[model samples]
Target: MGLIKTVGLTKTYNGTNAVDGIDLSIKEGVCTALLGPNGAGKTTTLNMLTGLINATSGTISFDDRYMGDRRKYIGYLPQYPKFYGWMTGEEYIIFSGQLAGLTKKEALSRSDELLSLVGLSEDKKKRVSGYSGGMKQRLGIAQSLIHSPKLLILDEPVSALDPIGRREVLELMKTLKEKTSILFSTHVLHDAEEICEEIFIIKKGKLIIEGDLVELQRKYQKPTIYLNTEEPIEDWSTTIKQKEWLRHMDVKKNKITVTVEDMDMAREALLTDESLRKLKINSFEVAKTTLEDLFMEVTGK
Candidate 1:
Protein backbone atom coordinates (compact mmCIF):
# COMPACT_ATOMS: atom_id res chain seq x y z
CA MET A 1 0.00 0.00 0.00
CA GLY A 2 1.09 3.61 -0.54
CA LEU A 3 2.45 5.40 2.52
CA ILE A 4 -0.32 8.00 2.25
CA LYS A 5 -3.69 7.48 0.61
CA THR A 6 -6.85 9.57 0.45
CA VAL A 7 -10.02 7.68 -0.46
CA GLY A 8 -12.75 9.90 -1.91
CA LEU A 9 -11.34 12.93 -0.09
CA THR A 10 -13.87 15.78 0.01
CA LYS A 11 -14.20 19.12 1.73
CA THR A 12 -16.98 21.72 1.71
CA TYR A 13 -17.55 25.24 2.99
CA ASN A 14 -20.76 27.28 3.25
CA GLY A 15 -22.72 24.46 1.63
CA THR A 16 -20.48 24.37 -1.44
CA ASN A 17 -17.82 21.78 -2.29
CA ALA A 18 -14.34 23.32 -2.43
CA VAL A 19 -12.65 19.95 -2.93
CA ASP A 20 -14.68 17.30 -4.61
CA GLY A 21 -14.12 13.57 -4.24
CA ILE A 22 -10.45 13.09 -5.23
CA ASP A 23 -8.20 10.16 -4.53
CA LEU A 24 -4.43 10.44 -4.08
CA SER A 25 -1.87 7.76 -3.21
CA ILE A 26 1.61 8.81 -2.29
CA LYS A 27 4.32 6.20 -2.63
CA GLU A 28 6.94 5.97 0.04
CA GLY A 29 10.21 7.85 -0.73
CA VAL A 30 8.84 9.44 -3.91
CA CYS A 31 8.53 13.16 -4.58
CA THR A 32 4.98 14.01 -5.63
CA ALA A 33 3.81 17.34 -7.01
CA LEU A 34 0.27 18.55 -6.34
CA LEU A 35 -0.26 20.97 -9.20
CA GLY A 36 -3.20 23.33 -9.61
CA PRO A 37 -3.91 26.96 -10.28
CA ASN A 38 -5.27 29.36 -7.68
CA GLY A 39 -8.60 28.33 -6.09
CA ALA A 40 -8.35 24.79 -7.42
CA GLY A 41 -8.63 23.46 -3.82
CA LYS A 42 -4.93 22.67 -3.48
CA THR A 43 -4.66 24.43 -0.14
CA THR A 44 -7.88 22.91 1.17
CA THR A 45 -6.70 19.43 0.18
CA LEU A 46 -3.33 20.03 1.85
CA ASN A 47 -4.90 21.33 5.05
CA MET A 48 -7.10 18.25 5.25
CA LEU A 49 -4.13 15.92 4.68
CA THR A 50 -2.19 17.60 7.49
CA GLY A 51 -5.21 17.51 9.82
CA LEU A 52 -5.07 21.31 10.13
CA ILE A 53 -8.64 21.48 8.83
CA ASN A 54 -11.47 18.92 9.07
CA ALA A 55 -12.76 17.18 5.98
CA THR A 56 -16.50 17.26 5.52
CA SER A 57 -16.43 13.70 4.22
CA GLY A 58 -14.08 10.88 3.14
CA THR A 59 -11.03 9.32 4.67
CA ILE A 60 -7.23 9.87 4.87
CA SER A 61 -5.13 6.86 5.82
CA PHE A 62 -1.44 6.69 6.66
CA ASP A 63 0.22 3.28 6.59
CA ASP A 64 -3.23 1.62 6.44
CA ARG A 65 -4.26 3.33 9.67
CA TYR A 66 -6.59 6.33 9.84
CA MET A 67 -4.95 8.43 12.53
CA GLY A 68 -7.40 11.07 13.77
CA ASP A 69 -4.39 13.37 14.14
CA ARG A 70 -1.67 13.12 11.47
CA ARG A 71 0.77 15.61 12.99
CA LYS A 72 2.97 12.81 14.29
CA TYR A 73 3.66 11.68 10.74
CA ILE A 74 3.38 14.96 8.81
CA GLY A 75 5.59 18.03 8.52
CA TYR A 76 3.77 20.92 6.85
CA LEU A 77 4.92 24.30 5.58
CA PRO A 78 2.23 26.70 4.45
CA GLN A 79 2.60 29.33 1.73
CA TYR A 80 3.46 31.90 4.34
CA PRO A 81 5.04 30.42 7.48
CA LYS A 82 4.87 32.91 10.31
CA PHE A 83 7.74 33.11 12.78
CA TYR A 84 8.43 35.16 15.85
CA GLY A 85 10.30 38.20 14.59
CA TRP A 86 11.91 38.51 18.01
CA MET A 87 13.32 35.01 17.95
CA THR A 88 16.53 33.96 16.24
CA GLY A 89 16.35 31.24 13.56
CA GLU A 90 18.24 28.96 15.92
CA GLU A 91 15.91 29.68 18.80
CA TYR A 92 12.81 29.17 16.69
CA ILE A 93 13.92 25.81 15.30
CA ILE A 94 14.98 24.60 18.75
CA PHE A 95 11.67 25.74 20.17
CA SER A 96 9.82 23.92 17.39
CA GLY A 97 11.77 20.73 18.07
CA GLN A 98 10.95 20.94 21.74
CA LEU A 99 7.25 21.43 20.98
CA ALA A 100 7.42 18.22 18.93
CA GLY A 101 8.53 16.36 22.09
CA LEU A 102 12.31 16.41 21.60
CA THR A 103 14.40 16.91 24.72
CA LYS A 104 16.19 20.26 25.15
CA LYS A 105 19.60 18.81 24.30
CA GLU A 106 18.17 16.87 21.36
CA ALA A 107 16.39 20.00 20.11
CA LEU A 108 19.63 21.93 20.29
CA SER A 109 21.50 19.25 18.37
CA ARG A 110 18.73 18.91 15.77
CA SER A 111 18.25 22.66 15.37
CA ASP A 112 21.92 23.17 14.56
CA GLU A 113 21.94 20.34 12.01
CA LEU A 114 18.69 21.41 10.39
CA LEU A 115 19.84 25.03 10.11
CA SER A 116 22.79 23.81 8.07
CA LEU A 117 20.58 21.55 5.98
CA VAL A 118 18.34 24.47 4.94
CA GLY A 119 21.27 26.86 4.43
CA LEU A 120 20.32 28.94 7.47
CA SER A 121 23.48 28.22 9.45
CA GLU A 122 25.01 31.57 8.65
CA ASP A 123 21.91 33.44 9.83
CA LYS A 124 20.92 31.05 12.61
CA LYS A 125 21.82 33.42 15.40
CA LYS A 126 20.20 36.51 13.83
CA ARG A 127 16.62 37.53 14.58
CA VAL A 128 14.18 36.15 12.00
CA SER A 129 13.04 39.71 11.19
CA GLY A 130 16.50 40.43 9.76
CA TYR A 131 16.33 37.50 7.34
CA SER A 132 15.18 37.67 3.73
CA GLY A 133 12.05 35.97 2.40
CA GLY A 134 14.10 32.97 1.21
CA MET A 135 15.74 32.63 4.62
CA LYS A 136 12.36 32.63 6.31
CA GLN A 137 11.06 29.92 3.97
CA ARG A 138 14.16 27.84 4.54
CA LEU A 139 13.75 28.32 8.26
CA GLY A 140 10.14 27.24 7.92
CA ILE A 141 11.32 24.04 6.23
CA ALA A 142 13.80 23.45 9.04
CA GLN A 143 11.10 23.86 11.68
CA SER A 144 8.72 21.53 9.88
CA LEU A 145 11.41 18.84 9.63
CA ILE A 146 12.35 19.14 13.27
CA HIS A 147 10.48 15.99 14.21
CA SER A 148 11.77 13.91 11.26
CA PRO A 149 8.25 13.09 10.18
CA LYS A 150 7.46 10.46 7.57
CA LEU A 151 5.89 12.90 5.09
CA LEU A 152 6.63 16.54 4.27
CA ILE A 153 3.96 18.82 2.82
CA LEU A 154 4.70 22.23 1.37
CA ASP A 155 2.21 24.66 -0.23
CA GLU A 156 3.65 26.88 -2.96
CA PRO A 157 7.11 26.42 -1.48
CA VAL A 158 8.83 28.75 -3.93
CA SER A 159 5.94 30.86 -5.26
CA ALA A 160 6.50 33.78 -2.87
CA LEU A 161 10.26 34.13 -3.43
CA ASP A 162 12.26 36.20 -5.87
CA PRO A 163 14.02 34.38 -8.76
CA ILE A 164 17.18 33.75 -6.72
CA GLY A 165 15.21 32.80 -3.63
CA ARG A 166 13.03 30.50 -5.69
CA ARG A 167 16.03 28.74 -7.17
CA GLU A 168 17.59 28.32 -3.74
CA VAL A 169 14.46 26.78 -2.21
CA LEU A 170 13.85 24.52 -5.21
CA GLU A 171 17.40 23.23 -4.99
CA LEU A 172 16.90 22.55 -1.31
CA MET A 173 13.66 20.70 -2.00
CA LYS A 174 15.37 18.62 -4.68
CA THR A 175 18.02 17.52 -2.21
CA LEU A 176 15.60 17.00 0.67
CA LYS A 177 13.46 14.57 -1.34
CA GLU A 178 16.26 11.98 -1.17
CA LYS A 179 15.75 11.78 2.59
CA THR A 180 11.98 12.14 2.96
CA SER A 181 8.69 11.60 1.18
CA ILE A 182 7.67 15.00 -0.19
CA LEU A 183 4.32 16.25 -1.49
CA PHE A 184 4.44 19.87 -2.55
CA SER A 185 1.88 22.01 -4.40
CA THR A 186 2.93 24.51 -7.03
CA HIS A 187 1.53 26.34 -10.05
CA VAL A 188 5.04 26.32 -11.50
CA LEU A 189 5.20 23.27 -13.76
CA HIS A 190 8.97 23.46 -14.11
CA ASP A 191 9.46 22.95 -10.38
CA ALA A 192 7.48 19.73 -10.57
CA GLU A 193 9.39 18.60 -13.63
CA GLU A 194 12.64 19.37 -11.89
CA ILE A 195 12.07 17.37 -8.72
CA CYS A 196 8.94 15.22 -8.68
CA GLU A 197 8.72 11.58 -9.71
CA GLU A 198 4.92 11.66 -9.95
CA ILE A 199 2.50 14.49 -10.75
CA PHE A 200 -1.12 15.10 -9.73
CA ILE A 201 -2.81 18.01 -11.48
CA ILE A 202 -6.09 19.42 -10.25
CA LYS A 203 -8.44 21.69 -12.12
CA LYS A 204 -11.57 23.27 -10.58
CA GLY A 205 -11.21 21.00 -7.54
CA LYS A 206 -11.07 17.84 -9.67
CA LEU A 207 -8.07 15.76 -10.64
CA ILE A 208 -7.28 16.18 -14.34
CA ILE A 209 -4.03 14.25 -14.65
CA GLU A 210 -1.95 11.86 -12.56
CA GLY A 211 1.05 9.94 -13.88
CA ASP A 212 4.80 9.62 -14.11
CA LEU A 213 6.37 12.44 -16.14
CA VAL A 214 8.02 10.37 -18.84
CA GLU A 215 5.03 8.05 -19.15
CA LEU A 216 2.62 10.94 -19.54
CA GLN A 217 4.81 12.71 -22.10
CA ARG A 218 5.19 9.51 -24.08
CA LYS A 219 1.47 8.80 -23.87
CA TYR A 220 0.52 12.24 -25.16
CA GLN A 221 3.47 12.60 -27.54
CA LYS A 222 3.12 15.39 -30.11
CA PRO A 223 6.20 15.33 -32.30
CA THR A 224 6.78 18.79 -33.67
CA ILE A 225 9.54 20.59 -35.60
CA TYR A 226 9.99 24.28 -34.82
CA LEU A 227 11.89 26.56 -37.18
CA ASN A 228 12.53 30.22 -36.55
CA THR A 229 13.80 32.79 -39.05
CA GLU A 230 15.65 36.04 -38.42
CA GLU A 231 13.84 37.50 -41.41
CA PRO A 232 10.47 36.41 -42.67
CA ILE A 233 10.56 34.25 -45.80
CA GLU A 234 7.62 35.20 -47.96
CA ASP A 235 7.19 31.67 -49.38
CA TRP A 236 7.47 29.93 -45.99
CA SER A 237 3.84 28.81 -46.16
CA THR A 238 4.20 27.38 -49.68
CA THR A 239 7.48 25.53 -48.84
CA ILE A 240 6.36 23.62 -45.73
CA LYS A 241 2.75 22.93 -46.75
CA GLN A 242 3.93 20.73 -49.63
CA LYS A 243 5.24 18.02 -47.29
CA GLU A 244 2.97 14.94 -47.11
CA TRP A 245 4.03 14.18 -43.52
CA LEU A 246 2.91 17.56 -42.15
CA ARG A 247 0.00 16.89 -39.80
CA HIS A 248 -0.52 20.59 -39.11
CA MET A 249 1.33 23.90 -39.07
CA ASP A 250 1.26 26.98 -36.89
CA VAL A 251 2.67 30.23 -38.16
CA LYS A 252 3.62 32.68 -35.47
CA LYS A 253 5.21 36.12 -35.82
CA ASN A 254 8.78 34.83 -35.99
CA LYS A 255 8.49 31.07 -36.16
CA ILE A 256 6.68 28.23 -37.88
CA THR A 257 5.81 25.01 -36.04
CA VAL A 258 5.09 21.83 -37.99
CA THR A 259 3.59 18.80 -36.27
CA VAL A 260 4.15 15.36 -37.77
CA GLU A 261 3.45 11.74 -37.05
CA ASP A 262 7.11 10.80 -37.16
CA MET A 263 9.72 13.25 -35.82
CA ASP A 264 12.74 11.56 -37.45
CA MET A 265 11.08 11.42 -40.88
CA ALA A 266 10.13 15.10 -40.70
CA ARG A 267 13.60 16.20 -39.56
CA GLU A 268 15.23 14.21 -42.40
CA ALA A 269 12.87 15.73 -44.95
CA LEU A 270 13.56 19.28 -43.69
CA LEU A 271 17.36 18.78 -43.75
CA THR A 272 17.64 16.94 -47.12
CA ASP A 273 15.30 19.23 -49.09
CA GLU A 274 17.62 21.73 -50.84
CA SER A 275 14.73 23.94 -51.96
CA LEU A 276 13.96 25.04 -48.37
CA ARG A 277 17.60 25.69 -47.32
CA LYS A 278 17.67 29.25 -48.75
CA LEU A 279 15.64 30.61 -45.83
CA LYS A 280 17.65 32.33 -43.11
CA ILE A 281 17.22 29.82 -40.28
CA ASN A 282 17.82 31.45 -36.88
CA SER A 283 16.93 28.50 -34.64
CA PHE A 284 15.52 25.02 -35.12
CA GLU A 285 14.36 22.39 -32.67
CA VAL A 286 12.57 19.02 -32.71
CA ALA A 287 10.71 18.12 -29.52
CA LYS A 288 7.68 16.39 -28.05
CA THR A 289 4.83 18.20 -26.30
CA THR A 290 5.77 19.71 -22.96
CA LEU A 291 4.15 19.66 -19.52
CA GLU A 292 3.04 23.24 -20.15
CA ASP A 293 1.03 22.11 -23.15
CA LEU A 294 -0.71 19.40 -21.12
CA PHE A 295 -1.26 21.88 -18.29
CA MET A 296 -2.83 24.44 -20.64
CA GLU A 297 -4.97 21.76 -22.23
CA VAL A 298 -6.24 20.50 -18.86
CA THR A 299 -6.51 23.83 -17.02
CA GLY A 300 -7.63 25.98 -20.00
CA LYS A 301 -5.91 29.04 -18.51
Candidate 2:
Protein backbone atom coordinates (compact mmCIF):
# COMPACT_ATOMS: atom_id res chain seq x y z
CA MET A 1 0.00 0.00 0.00
CA GLY A 2 1.15 3.57 -0.66
CA LEU A 3 1.81 6.08 2.08
CA ILE A 4 0.16 8.65 -0.22
CA LYS A 5 -2.00 8.08 -3.28
CA THR A 6 -3.64 10.34 -5.82
CA VAL A 7 -6.62 9.27 -7.94
CA GLY A 8 -7.24 11.08 -11.22
CA LEU A 9 -5.53 14.12 -9.67
CA THR A 10 -5.85 17.23 -11.75
CA LYS A 11 -5.72 21.02 -11.83
CA THR A 12 -7.02 23.51 -14.40
CA TYR A 13 -6.46 27.15 -15.25
CA ASN A 14 -8.25 29.31 -17.82
CA GLY A 15 -10.12 26.36 -19.35
CA THR A 16 -6.98 24.27 -19.83
CA ASN A 17 -5.94 21.30 -17.72
CA ALA A 18 -2.54 22.08 -16.32
CA VAL A 19 -2.46 18.74 -14.60
CA ASP A 20 -4.43 16.07 -16.38
CA GLY A 21 -6.01 13.08 -14.75
CA ILE A 22 -2.95 11.33 -13.34
CA ASP A 23 -2.77 8.68 -10.64
CA LEU A 24 0.22 8.21 -8.34
CA SER A 25 1.31 5.95 -5.48
CA ILE A 26 4.21 6.95 -3.30
CA LYS A 27 5.62 4.13 -1.20
CA GLU A 28 6.92 4.78 2.30
CA GLY A 29 10.54 4.82 3.45
CA VAL A 30 12.08 5.30 0.03
CA CYS A 31 13.07 8.06 -2.36
CA THR A 32 10.81 8.70 -5.36
CA ALA A 33 11.24 11.29 -8.08
CA LEU A 34 8.61 13.19 -10.13
CA LEU A 35 10.32 13.72 -13.46
CA GLY A 36 9.29 15.89 -16.41
CA PRO A 37 10.54 18.62 -18.61
CA ASN A 38 9.71 22.19 -17.59
CA GLY A 39 6.01 23.20 -17.80
CA ALA A 40 4.83 19.61 -17.36
CA GLY A 41 2.75 20.43 -14.26
CA LYS A 42 5.20 18.82 -11.82
CA THR A 43 4.96 21.84 -9.51
CA THR A 44 1.18 21.88 -9.68
CA THR A 45 0.94 18.20 -8.75
CA LEU A 46 3.28 18.70 -5.81
CA ASN A 47 1.40 21.77 -4.65
CA MET A 48 -1.84 19.81 -4.50
CA LEU A 49 -0.14 16.97 -2.60
CA THR A 50 1.31 19.39 -0.04
CA GLY A 51 -2.06 21.18 0.39
CA LEU A 52 -0.56 24.38 -0.97
CA ILE A 53 -3.30 24.26 -3.61
CA ASN A 54 -6.58 22.40 -4.08
CA ALA A 55 -7.02 19.80 -6.79
CA THR A 56 -9.49 20.76 -9.45
CA SER A 57 -11.05 17.31 -9.63
CA GLY A 58 -9.39 14.47 -7.80
CA THR A 59 -8.67 12.89 -4.45
CA ILE A 60 -5.46 13.30 -2.46
CA SER A 61 -5.48 10.50 0.07
CA PHE A 62 -3.02 9.77 2.84
CA ASP A 63 -2.90 6.54 4.78
CA ASP A 64 -5.69 6.22 7.34
CA ARG A 65 -2.99 6.01 9.99
CA TYR A 66 -2.33 9.72 9.44
CA MET A 67 -5.54 11.46 10.32
CA GLY A 68 -6.62 15.10 10.83
CA ASP A 69 -5.08 17.93 8.78
CA ARG A 70 -2.92 16.47 5.99
CA ARG A 71 -0.36 19.28 6.30
CA LYS A 72 0.74 17.94 9.66
CA TYR A 73 2.04 14.78 7.99
CA ILE A 74 3.99 16.51 5.25
CA GLY A 75 7.17 18.61 5.07
CA TYR A 76 7.51 20.72 1.91
CA LEU A 77 10.37 22.70 0.42
CA PRO A 78 9.43 24.63 -2.71
CA GLN A 79 11.59 25.02 -5.81
CA TYR A 80 12.43 28.57 -4.81
CA PRO A 81 12.42 28.89 -1.04
CA LYS A 82 12.17 32.30 0.58
CA PHE A 83 13.99 33.11 3.80
CA TYR A 84 14.38 36.16 6.02
CA GLY A 85 17.77 37.56 5.10
CA TRP A 86 18.14 39.18 8.53
CA MET A 87 17.50 35.97 10.47
CA THR A 88 20.26 33.56 11.35
CA GLY A 89 19.91 29.98 10.07
CA GLU A 90 19.28 28.79 13.63
CA GLU A 91 16.64 31.45 14.22
CA TYR A 92 14.90 30.67 10.92
CA ILE A 93 14.50 27.00 11.74
CA ILE A 94 13.16 27.78 15.17
CA PHE A 95 10.66 30.21 13.66
CA SER A 96 9.51 27.63 11.13
CA GLY A 97 9.05 25.14 13.96
CA GLN A 98 6.91 27.59 15.88
CA LEU A 99 4.80 28.26 12.78
CA ALA A 100 4.27 24.53 12.51
CA GLY A 101 2.85 24.59 16.08
CA LEU A 102 5.91 23.67 18.09
CA THR A 103 6.39 25.32 21.45
CA LYS A 104 9.33 27.70 21.84
CA LYS A 105 11.36 25.17 23.79
CA GLU A 106 10.54 22.35 21.39
CA ALA A 107 11.40 24.49 18.40
CA LEU A 108 14.75 25.39 19.88
CA SER A 109 15.63 21.76 20.54
CA ARG A 110 14.50 20.59 17.09
CA SER A 111 16.46 23.36 15.40
CA ASP A 112 19.72 22.07 16.82
CA GLU A 113 19.04 18.50 15.77
CA LEU A 114 17.92 19.36 12.25
CA LEU A 115 20.72 21.80 11.62
CA SER A 116 23.17 19.09 12.54
CA LEU A 117 21.46 16.60 10.25
CA VAL A 118 21.78 18.97 7.27
CA GLY A 119 25.43 19.76 8.15
CA LEU A 120 24.62 23.40 8.88
CA SER A 121 25.22 23.32 12.63
CA GLU A 122 28.56 25.12 12.37
CA ASP A 123 27.04 27.93 10.30
CA LYS A 124 23.76 28.06 12.21
CA LYS A 125 24.72 31.39 13.72
CA LYS A 126 25.37 33.08 10.40
CA ARG A 127 22.76 35.31 8.79
CA VAL A 128 20.83 33.71 5.92
CA SER A 129 21.85 36.52 3.53
CA GLY A 130 25.52 35.55 3.76
CA TYR A 131 25.07 31.85 2.99
CA SER A 132 25.89 30.37 -0.40
CA GLY A 133 23.22 28.83 -2.66
CA GLY A 134 23.97 25.35 -1.34
CA MET A 135 24.10 26.50 2.29
CA LYS A 136 20.74 28.20 1.99
CA GLN A 137 19.20 25.06 0.46
CA ARG A 138 20.51 22.99 3.38
CA LEU A 139 18.98 25.51 5.76
CA GLY A 140 15.63 25.25 3.95
CA ILE A 141 15.73 21.47 4.23
CA ALA A 142 16.41 21.75 7.95
CA GLN A 143 13.47 24.09 8.37
CA SER A 144 11.19 21.63 6.60
CA LEU A 145 12.20 18.81 8.94
CA ILE A 146 11.61 20.93 12.03
CA HIS A 147 8.11 19.47 12.22
CA SER A 148 9.34 15.89 11.82
CA PRO A 149 6.63 15.04 9.33
CA LYS A 150 6.15 11.54 7.88
CA LEU A 151 6.84 12.66 4.30
CA LEU A 152 9.35 15.18 2.95
CA ILE A 153 8.79 16.83 -0.46
CA LEU A 154 11.37 18.89 -2.30
CA ASP A 155 10.78 20.65 -5.65
CA GLU A 156 13.78 20.95 -7.95
CA PRO A 157 16.13 21.01 -4.95
CA VAL A 158 19.43 21.31 -6.79
CA SER A 159 18.30 22.69 -10.15
CA ALA A 160 19.66 26.19 -9.67
CA LEU A 161 22.99 25.41 -8.06
CA ASP A 162 26.52 25.36 -9.46
CA PRO A 163 28.21 21.98 -9.79
CA ILE A 164 29.71 22.16 -6.31
CA GLY A 165 26.42 23.23 -4.72
CA ARG A 166 24.47 20.58 -6.65
CA ARG A 167 26.81 17.83 -5.41
CA GLU A 168 26.51 18.98 -1.79
CA VAL A 169 22.69 18.86 -1.81
CA LEU A 170 22.55 15.57 -3.72
CA GLU A 171 24.83 13.94 -1.13
CA LEU A 172 22.69 15.32 1.71
CA MET A 173 19.58 13.89 0.05
CA LYS A 174 21.29 10.47 -0.11
CA THR A 175 21.69 10.57 3.65
CA LEU A 176 18.17 11.86 4.35
CA LYS A 177 16.50 9.05 2.35
CA GLU A 178 17.66 6.53 5.00
CA LYS A 179 15.86 8.47 7.72
CA THR A 180 12.61 9.50 5.98
CA SER A 181 10.43 9.02 2.94
CA ILE A 182 11.31 11.56 0.25
CA LEU A 183 9.38 12.71 -2.84
CA PHE A 184 11.40 15.11 -4.90
CA SER A 185 10.81 16.60 -8.39
CA THR A 186 13.60 17.06 -10.88
CA HIS A 187 14.27 16.99 -14.65
CA VAL A 188 17.86 15.89 -14.24
CA LEU A 189 17.76 12.15 -14.97
CA HIS A 190 21.20 11.46 -13.48
CA ASP A 191 20.26 12.77 -10.04
CA ALA A 192 17.08 10.68 -9.89
CA GLU A 193 18.95 7.58 -11.11
CA GLU A 194 21.49 8.08 -8.35
CA ILE A 195 19.10 8.16 -5.37
CA CYS A 196 15.55 7.15 -6.21
CA GLU A 197 14.10 3.66 -5.95
CA GLU A 198 10.94 4.54 -7.87
CA ILE A 199 10.10 7.20 -10.45
CA PHE A 200 7.01 8.71 -12.06
CA ILE A 201 7.57 10.48 -15.34
CA ILE A 202 5.17 13.16 -16.53
CA LYS A 203 4.87 14.75 -19.95
CA LYS A 204 2.59 17.57 -21.10
CA GLY A 205 0.79 17.26 -17.77
CA LYS A 206 0.07 13.54 -18.24
CA LEU A 207 1.50 10.61 -16.33
CA ILE A 208 3.41 8.59 -18.92
CA ILE A 209 5.43 6.20 -16.79
CA GLU A 210 5.62 5.06 -13.18
CA GLY A 211 7.47 2.09 -11.70
CA ASP A 212 10.44 0.85 -9.71
CA LEU A 213 13.59 2.33 -11.28
CA VAL A 214 15.52 -0.93 -11.45
CA GLU A 215 12.60 -2.91 -12.82
CA LEU A 216 11.86 -0.33 -15.48
CA GLN A 217 15.51 -0.23 -16.46
CA ARG A 218 15.59 -3.97 -16.96
CA LYS A 219 12.27 -4.05 -18.77
CA TYR A 220 13.34 -1.44 -21.32
CA GLN A 221 17.00 -2.44 -21.44
CA LYS A 222 18.78 -3.12 -24.74
CA PRO A 223 22.05 -4.89 -25.38
CA THR A 224 24.43 -2.08 -26.22
CA ILE A 225 28.17 -1.44 -26.41
CA TYR A 226 30.12 1.82 -26.56
CA LEU A 227 33.52 2.05 -28.22
CA ASN A 228 35.80 5.06 -28.47
CA THR A 229 38.96 5.03 -30.49
CA GLU A 230 41.92 7.39 -30.85
CA GLU A 231 40.83 7.78 -34.49
CA PRO A 232 37.57 7.73 -36.44
CA ILE A 233 35.90 4.30 -36.83
CA GLU A 234 33.31 5.14 -39.52
CA ASP A 235 34.91 2.87 -42.11
CA TRP A 236 35.26 0.01 -39.66
CA SER A 237 31.63 0.29 -38.53
CA THR A 238 30.49 0.10 -42.19
CA THR A 239 32.45 -3.14 -42.53
CA ILE A 240 30.40 -4.84 -39.73
CA LYS A 241 27.07 -3.21 -40.62
CA GLN A 242 25.97 -6.32 -42.51
CA LYS A 243 26.45 -8.72 -39.55
CA GLU A 244 23.16 -10.32 -38.50
CA TRP A 245 23.95 -9.85 -34.78
CA LEU A 246 24.37 -6.09 -35.24
CA ARG A 247 21.02 -4.37 -34.86
CA HIS A 248 22.12 -0.75 -35.16
CA MET A 249 25.29 1.29 -34.93
CA ASP A 250 25.83 5.03 -34.51
CA VAL A 251 29.13 6.68 -35.33
CA LYS A 252 30.03 10.17 -34.16
CA LYS A 253 33.56 11.40 -34.73
CA ASN A 254 35.88 8.90 -32.93
CA LYS A 255 33.09 7.09 -31.02
CA ILE A 256 30.85 4.21 -32.05
CA THR A 257 27.77 3.05 -30.11
CA VAL A 258 26.18 -0.19 -31.23
CA THR A 259 22.97 -2.01 -30.38
CA VAL A 260 23.14 -5.76 -30.79
CA GLU A 261 20.64 -8.60 -31.02
CA ASP A 262 23.07 -11.08 -29.50
CA MET A 263 25.54 -9.68 -26.97
CA ASP A 264 27.74 -12.78 -26.84
CA MET A 265 28.12 -13.07 -30.62
CA ALA A 266 28.60 -9.35 -31.09
CA ARG A 267 31.26 -9.29 -28.39
CA GLU A 268 33.14 -12.18 -29.95
CA ALA A 269 32.97 -10.73 -33.46
CA LEU A 270 34.12 -7.23 -32.42
CA LEU A 271 36.95 -8.47 -30.18
CA THR A 272 38.42 -10.64 -32.93
CA ASP A 273 37.96 -8.31 -35.92
CA GLU A 274 41.38 -7.62 -37.51
CA SER A 275 40.40 -4.08 -38.47
CA LEU A 276 39.44 -3.22 -34.89
CA ARG A 277 42.75 -4.63 -33.62
CA LYS A 278 44.71 -2.15 -35.75
CA LEU A 279 42.96 0.85 -34.12
CA LYS A 280 44.12 2.24 -30.76
CA ILE A 281 40.95 1.85 -28.71
CA ASN A 282 40.53 4.52 -26.05
CA SER A 283 37.76 2.70 -24.19
CA PHE A 284 35.22 -0.08 -24.67
CA GLU A 285 32.20 -0.55 -22.44
CA VAL A 286 29.16 -2.78 -22.31
CA ALA A 287 26.11 -1.06 -20.83
CA LYS A 288 22.38 -1.46 -20.56
CA THR A 289 19.89 1.25 -21.49
CA THR A 290 20.06 4.01 -18.86
CA LEU A 291 17.25 6.10 -17.40
CA GLU A 292 18.21 8.97 -19.68
CA ASP A 293 17.81 6.68 -22.65
CA LEU A 294 14.42 5.57 -21.41
CA PHE A 295 13.36 9.15 -20.77
CA MET A 296 14.34 10.23 -24.25
CA GLU A 297 12.55 7.28 -25.80
CA VAL A 298 9.30 7.96 -23.99
CA THR A 299 9.31 11.74 -24.10
CA GLY A 300 10.27 11.76 -27.82
CA LYS A 301 13.00 14.28 -27.16
Best by TM-score: 2
- Please give the distance, in angstroms, between residue 42's alpha carbon in candidate 2 and its true position after superposition: 1.2
Q: Write one digit per residue (lDDT tens) for candidate 2, span 13-80.
A: 98899999989999999999999999889999999999999999989899889999878889899999
How does each model score on TM-score?
0.84, 0.85
lDDT of model number 2 = 0.91
Q: What is the lDDT of residue 252 in candidate 2?
A: 94
Which runs in model 2 stand beyond 4 Å of their true positions?
Answer: 226-256, 264-286
| CA error at residue 21 for candidate 2, angstroms | 1.6
Clashes of each: 0, 0
Off by over 4 Å in 1: 65-68, 227-256, 263-285
- Give the alpha carbon lDDT tens digit for every residue of 119-196 in model 1: 989889999999988889999999999988889999999999999899889999988999999999998888898889
